[model samples]
Target: MCRPTAPRRGYDYRALIMKLSYQLVEQSWPLAKEFRISRGAKTQANVLLLALSDGEHVAWGESVPYARYGETLTSVSQQIERIMPLLSSQTSGEQLNQMMPAGAARNLVDCALWDLRAKKANASVATLLGLTPASTVITAQTLSIDTKERMAAEARTIGNAQLIKIKLDEHDIIEKMEQIHLAAPQSQFIIDANEAWSFETLIQVLPALAKLNVALIEQPLPSNNDTDLATLSSPIPICADESCHVSADLAKLKGKYQAINIKLDKAGGLTEAVKLMQAATEQGFIIMTGCMVGTSLAMAPAYLLSGASSFVDLDGPLLIAKDRDNGFTFADGQMQPHSSAFWGGENNQTNVELARLFTS
Candidate 1:
């Protein structure tokens, strides 16, 4: 079975004895346009940033408090605050994973610890994880749910994207897919129903979607109704988003889903995400690395899973009105690797300034 490789040998753990300090900052980034999914719509991305320091080098991580998962900014902050007293410079990511349950609160802390360790070791997180950095990855540009005409217009506007992810609801499933396919015939499509469709609706739309050459269908039924999928004989691959989280969920999803979407927040951070990837791969499931709407800080760590994923959807920054100074760069649906100083690399003057800006 595939597993997360151990950290490189000869790392001096004793040198990290300095007392640890932490801060949680809440911020909101406006969206370029309304981002709508099957469940609802939002105009801004509300995120909590975590900063971990040991009196010298500083590292950062971010997570979006999703109400869909019973998390609000206040609750997430309280979660981190409750655990602050128990944390120390020596606390490892694996230990943090055990101390907290899987959710956005644990996601920030777990990711920040990884960044902190990488900074202390003067190496990138990928280097510490024994992963080769990817030069660039083709990310799926998303088109929010809208009228068929407008959705088609948006699809035409992003004609250059190699992959397009469409957010859909129960209404007009066939019409919308037909319009979008006509508009951007060259681009492969991923239809995300976000748990809006009923089993009957899904049964009705399967053949039409398959005809459109849809690459994947994501979470067409509510997570509670995952058993219904075991009855399906879908032509296109079906990926589990809300239905799957950590590696443990894979067994339950075995006959239901052919693919799984790994989001850092849902998986509790990259630490568990890597393990989920390994487990899902071993079980013969295709992997798609996904993300919540946030910023480059959120996407940077998730990017590590790109090389292992067949479909990459780390396009959070692209939907926002503006991103941080050193966000990931996207061109023609391709995302380039972030600068080392961004998050998971050796500490630099820029990182120190970034921490100051967020903590000040």
Candidate 2:
């Protein structure tokens, strides 16, 4: 059996007494309303939370096991369980990166480690990482793929949002854009096809989509078929959501994608996401930080990326029915970073509620 070793003479007792541990839980939250994209629709946001403890303080991180990426809640939880014994304060981010493949499971553990390290250093995660706490972040409000009327109604609801991300499919063509544009003429739009368009659709609709005063078009072509985007010209910028993952993807996307959507979930966590942003920015690609449908715990780390990005799409918590108490605030589409008590900072009872999420 394994055993704990005692500290040597004059050794700091705190170092020897402290233990690092983690717990993984499956959680689901109902959507405030329907949210759909090119892939499908979801009524609830299924998520996995990784809670890390340092025998003194606890911190949390959350990840959505995106079905679009072939991940489900059960698969994500089992992946976390496999690496439980290896989690420790001594395990560096580099070590974690080497231990797990980049996906939902790595994202969960990597973020939890960041939170725990902030606690160990007695600083907020943002502070520990040398980032300013944002007073407010402008986040995109999404209008899911739907009938013209429903899409229009949803667009109208977020008429005051500075940026509205409109999910599109190949079928609607001009109908949905016409309605949503007419409904919220004042708001800038991100026309996100989410890989629903074909080469012909891209050719046929680029002109009309350009005329809609769209600020950006995201992943209009399927990830596997978008290699030729560089050959086409566009008035509005085209962003890469599915095509770009880690920093290594930049070479393939250099001339093809004008912008890259950096989501913590997709990049595996903030550690790699930060490297992705720096790499994308260096290559002159516009940066947009996005999110999967998760709670504030997932979006919080991504919020730190907002300062370095031109467009911020961290609105997952906004679409969910009930977020954690004291989660990040989104009012009038303007985001405020979560309080220290929300994630890595001091809080007495938040962990109790977080624990209950696993039980109830």
Candidate 3:
């Protein structure tokens, strides 16, 4: 029930009453390689980009419609269109939360609203939220599910990485872990099963994974079957990805997962993401900020959470073949802060022009 705060001194309240215009654009960015996980593989990142304008400042937001969450581009678009008439310059984040259910559709609109507010206020989102912007953050470089040899080779290629996340299924669990560990012994590992493991498989692989310096295990068991985790003790920390979304889900995850993965797409956007992060920290859950396979545009807002996260997995741009102009820069596994003009900052003529191109 958090409401918008009172306007600051010199703020123009009239802007809040202005009529808002919006446009939804579909974009497809090719992946550098096939990204494989327990569910399937994808060669490209299909996203829905949302643009919001108040006849002056323009703001942008992007979200990936994941089939795993029963979200498709058409369905997400319809959800946004249905809610469009309710949105105005006066809409508050809390109001939006009540207006739409948390998912990819809400994520796209929520982020666009944040960007719009920041622009109208002539401030950065970080500054408005009272957070110090990070210059660079250590991000996990992910190795997709593949043959043992190929996965090991990929690990070796990024041997200097501080954190490496490996996607795995229920098959050849120990063998793949051993091979990848041998190839990158210096690097810590995060095993992301994407809910492909059973209680028996997870128990069997725990010892081997612990010995291999695996720092964490992500969603090893299906969301519905994860109650089994509370019954057994695990060596490495367990993180909930698919099982946990909004702050309301945290109560059930207690004693089951040591951590939770906060993806803007999953949390619905930065607005809810901030609430979830604060609640998760207060409950002593390890924070891991992650992302769906997306371009830098999607990562920009999520990057704001890196300072508070113990594990950062915002390497979606690294997996993509190309990124938007002025995208975030990644070097030796660290993602440098993006330009203010790129996203989540004061009004920029460049972004307004870009919005015009997409919306026109």
**Candidate 1 C-alpha lDDT tens digits along 285-344:** 999999999999999999998888899999999999988867799999999887889889
TM-scores for all predictions: 0.93, 0.90, 0.93
lDDT of 2 by residue, 1-360 (tens): 111133224422122212755555666688888898888898988787766666666677989888778898778777777677666776777788788887888888888888777767777667766665457988999888889999999888888888998988888868888889888888888988989998778788778877776899999998889978989787888899989888888999877889999988788887788788888888899999899988888888888887788899988888888787777888879998776766766333345655543334
TM-score of 1: 0.93
Model 1 misplaced regions, further than 4 Å = 1-18, 347-349
TM-score of 2: 0.90
lDDT of 3 by residue, 1-360 (tens): 112233235423223233786667778888889999999999988888877878877788899999999999878988887788788867888899999999999999988888888888888888877765467989999999999999999999999999999999999999999999999999999999999999999888888888998999999999988999999799999999999999999999999999999999999988899999999999999999999998888998899888889999999999988788777998889888777888887655446435654454
lDDT of each: 0.87, 0.79, 0.87
Clashes of 2: 0
Better of 2 and 3 by lDDT: 3
